[model samples]
Target: MTAPLSRRSLLGLVGAGAGAYLLGGCSGDDSSDDPDAPQTINWWHIQNTEPMLPVWAAMAEEYRGAHSNVTIEIQPLENEAFKAKLTTATQAGSPPDLFQSWGGGVLKQQLDAGLVKDLTDDVKPWVDGLLPASLQPYTIDGRIYGIPFDVGMVGFWYNKDLFSQAGITETPTTWAGVLDTVRKLKAAGTVPIALAGKDKWPVHNYWAYLAMRIGGLGALQQAAKDGNFDTPDFVAAGERLKELADLQPFQPGFLGAEYGSPDGQAAIMGNGGAAMELMGQWAPSMQASSSTSKKGIGDKLGFFTFPTVEGGKGNATDAFGGGNGFAVGKDAPAATIDFLKFLLTADNQRTSAKTGAVLPTVKEAVDAVTDANNKTVAETLASATGFQLYLDQAYPPAVGQQVNDSVAELVAGSKTPAQIVKDITQVAKSQ
Candidate 1:
């Protein structure tokens, strides 16, 4: 039940948990007049914020300072738009020198299409130092291809204040316990959980966790990759989600809520409108970004592995998450490769951790995380007994999209488990 140290981890988490991707230069051509001077390394990422932006900018600046000849240009893009644009750009052979990518089938698609550079030799030193599971997804056909900059997982982020108010002393670790807590919280006039289904991908997180909890990692992977959506295991997992929904567990109108919004699902938990949230470690930053949003947010935000169902094949410690990092494009210039190595150094990894991105890949850098919450995240991932790449990311691109739409339909109460399975089975068959 050890976390699958397979090639799916890197791709699964990013596509499932975050809705962004690094594409080609959105402006137009590379436009570097230095045909023989120095390579202009282009980086596409979505963390274009105050502190996050400054950190990446500094890394770029410092990288340029050291390399002297190379210039790193970071272009930020809107999440959904970037993914679409990147897909188009990559197809047209205009991919950036090195761009950010989510792990799993997303990266695999590019790998299958020969759009990304194979970095087996380049990543040897880092690979030797990484935990096996962490390195699995970035590698293909025995060659490493990408570097993990930052990685994190999704779990139950709970408001301790809300829990105490509901007379709940222990964090729930089983399906029954989760139900009990929801009932108690409701009696106390608080919604038990907050979930944002509007973005669709966030909804897939719950489905993946529940499927892993019920069927185990290997089964989920097989079903996801093969489109075996009709299995009893998948149906059982869908039922668990419905169980939570039946309890009136989610915040009011959560189905239509915004995702990645500080005031969305996390906001519901932050304001005491809900007792807990099924969200990633990034929830804190969103919660703390605004003055009003900071009301009940605290170090007391307790976390627990997604609860398990009795007799489920998946173990309690098996969690869902992955990493996103830069990989050289197939047509990258030699100078760009040199610049990329500079960005992957231990020092830069440490700087990225300080930006609130959880669990950086560098051994030395992640070891230096002083924040208790960050430390907990590192421990949780390390201690996990089993893991699965997020379902959508683990499957083919077409299947991934179908899974997202299926889960969204299930959550919206428009599709039954049987119908969803049949629908996805067709998608899987087509692939």
Candidate 2:
């Protein structure tokens, strides 16, 4: 599981800017290479945990076990460190054979660098049946470049026990209702929502959701693709986000909180002090790790899509997210593609889904989940009217950073809607 897409998306998007690269791999200096020497396929990922580390180990083991002639090496690093290393490796012309990446814009950067291989021929049948919206991010010039392993939507994950204690019976379904609910929750001595604004990424999610509610998915995507930040639609979205920020719905000093830490936010929600969390399916894993997991509070957690602004162009079901998946690198051995094809089969996806990792991208695997919570997430994703790729991935990197920074400043009362619009527009145009 990753940081909530809404907040983390922009950060991840603005993330891999030029940095000190870590260049370490097989020597390109080998003089007499046996043509039939087994290929070593390096798989890089940011799994800084025992639990996730084993998942990757299993993937590598299974892949290598089957291919016999191919050895898959797993390289795990801290998130930021991984990007820096990737930047270095690619520049050094000693990149990994395959690696983990978000399926859209992140992959596009590598694609442009001539670092990633076009997987269109191998993935066509699988890509063809994807949800209509899922196709756009992976398609660069009408060719597929990545396989989506986990695709899910972002939403409000709430503490139902807190809601019930506050006498609220149902999840709010519109923007007005969200405000009203937050007000009641705050007045009742519960934190209305948890926003880790210090991270900057969570703040980005607020802006993207605000924009989608005001302008709809198509409008937001259009602005992103055309690099038009000053459109009326974007301005309206900025204003709506500003309104949400002014409500002071987050815990005091939440603007100074570290987001990537699961314990901090989970503690607030699990204690029944926070009514809702604007997050993704990853919330479930956090819940599982909480003290409340045994007390039954974890089981009562509820989720709903971010509500649409009433009478706004967007539907309540419009969502924003991307699938995290594997991408084959340029010049990968034949066995590498075979390994990916095997691992991506419907059966393996179901196995991966059981880890509470994410909503599987394969339609059939998603249908096969028996867990109720996982199923709810699956159903919510499948039911979405459309999904906007996380804003960071939807736009250029610098533009994404400006949007993220604007939201953080706006929420802290250091900027206004007009100011944010101008700042983001300037960045977008410059990009």
Candidate 3:
């Protein structure tokens, strides 16, 4: 499975005044006679493990075979290591020809510095073949800067068997109903939620979704623009999260739980020790990998969109998630773009979906998703009214980390709702 979107670090890599120096040159031959020219495309991605690692290598080999004059150099790095290496490379005014990108605030920064190519005209012929929502994160100020290969959204991944045991006849549709569900699960002697408290990203999702429900999508963008997050709606989001925490809904010793470890959130749910977890489309694969039996709960797993908050302005269809994509570096060879197009063909996407590693972004490849749980997530995202990338990816690294830190303190009962918002606001302004 792909690593969490929040693992990327964008700090100091694309700061103010860095753009001017990075935008100095253009690379790649636009001439027609370049077909015979030998070229190399440096590519980097974070799928360092199977299914995707081999899948990507196979795709690259195929592309290379098709173009004997071109060579694809693939570097599969761990999540955090990729971010660190990319930071050093970009800051040195050089980036791989094609590299992994989450495509939000960080991509915007890179684009501002002219470190990446604008693919609007180049990809026009085939861009429509992909889902529009999946492209949302890569499109900045009316131009396309990246191409998405996978897409997904965050929602409640629950054990249907456990819900039945808790006597819940229907899935909750509102915040009150969710709380009631938690109460019922607890009363029935089940852990209502499994949280990876050691990883702040999972905790941030609760506050982020709450804010979206309370203030609507515009509130987040507006806050980022104004460098302020200490609004009434944001504070109320924290309070609502506090209400959920007050019920003691998490698994025992959850404050130190890791995300992918044997004793982590996914394992708890996969092993039937917990009723639910709020996670992305990749949850099932993660559950299976972390489980003792090496197989997840299978058909016993169910999913539902996050519940609406009473009197909130946001629509239920406003989705909160992000996905993976590829960005072209400023100095890449012309053949790099061709290799990218080749990698995203319908057949390639279908193969990727078959691996159950991605929620295919290619519209034609959607039917190839054999996993039941992922199919549901793809359907939900297809009809979404709006999309919000994870907060950690949607903002500058420092601001995003501040959100995680503040929310973690709130979850641990060390900070109040007002103080959380204030802390986040202070860091946002500094950015």
TM-scores, all candidates, are: 0.88, 0.85, 0.88
TM-score of 2: 0.85
Off by over 4 Å in 3: 1-35
> What is the full ranking by TM-score, best candidate first?
3, 1, 2
The residue pairs found clashing in candidate 2 are 6-205, 7-201, 7-202
What C-alpha lDDT values do all the predictions have?
Answer: 0.67, 0.65, 0.80
Stretches of candidate 1 off by over 4 Å are 1-36, 270-272, 290-296
lDDT per residue for candidate 3 within 350-386, as digits (tens), equals: 9988877688889889889988888898889878899
Judged by lDDT relative to the true structure, which candidate is superior, 1 or 2?
1
Clash pairs for candidate 3: none
Worst lDDT 10-window in candidate 2: 7-16
Error of 1 at 154 (Å): 1.7
Per-residue lDDT tens digits of candidate 1, residues 1-431?
Answer: 00111111221112212333322222323445454455566677655433355576676777666655565667765344456678798889778777766556677889888888888876665566655676665767677777766666777788888899889999987988888999999999987888766667767777778888888897776875566779988888888887777777777778887544555664666565667876665655544542254434777677787888898998888878766667778877666766666766778777767755445777778766766776787799888887666566567777777877887888888998778777888998898
Clash count, predicted structure 1: 7
lDDT-better candidate, 2 vs 3:
3
**After superposition, which runs of candidate 2 have C-alpha atoms over 4 Å from their true positions?**
1-36, 78-81, 88-94, 124-135, 270-273, 290-296
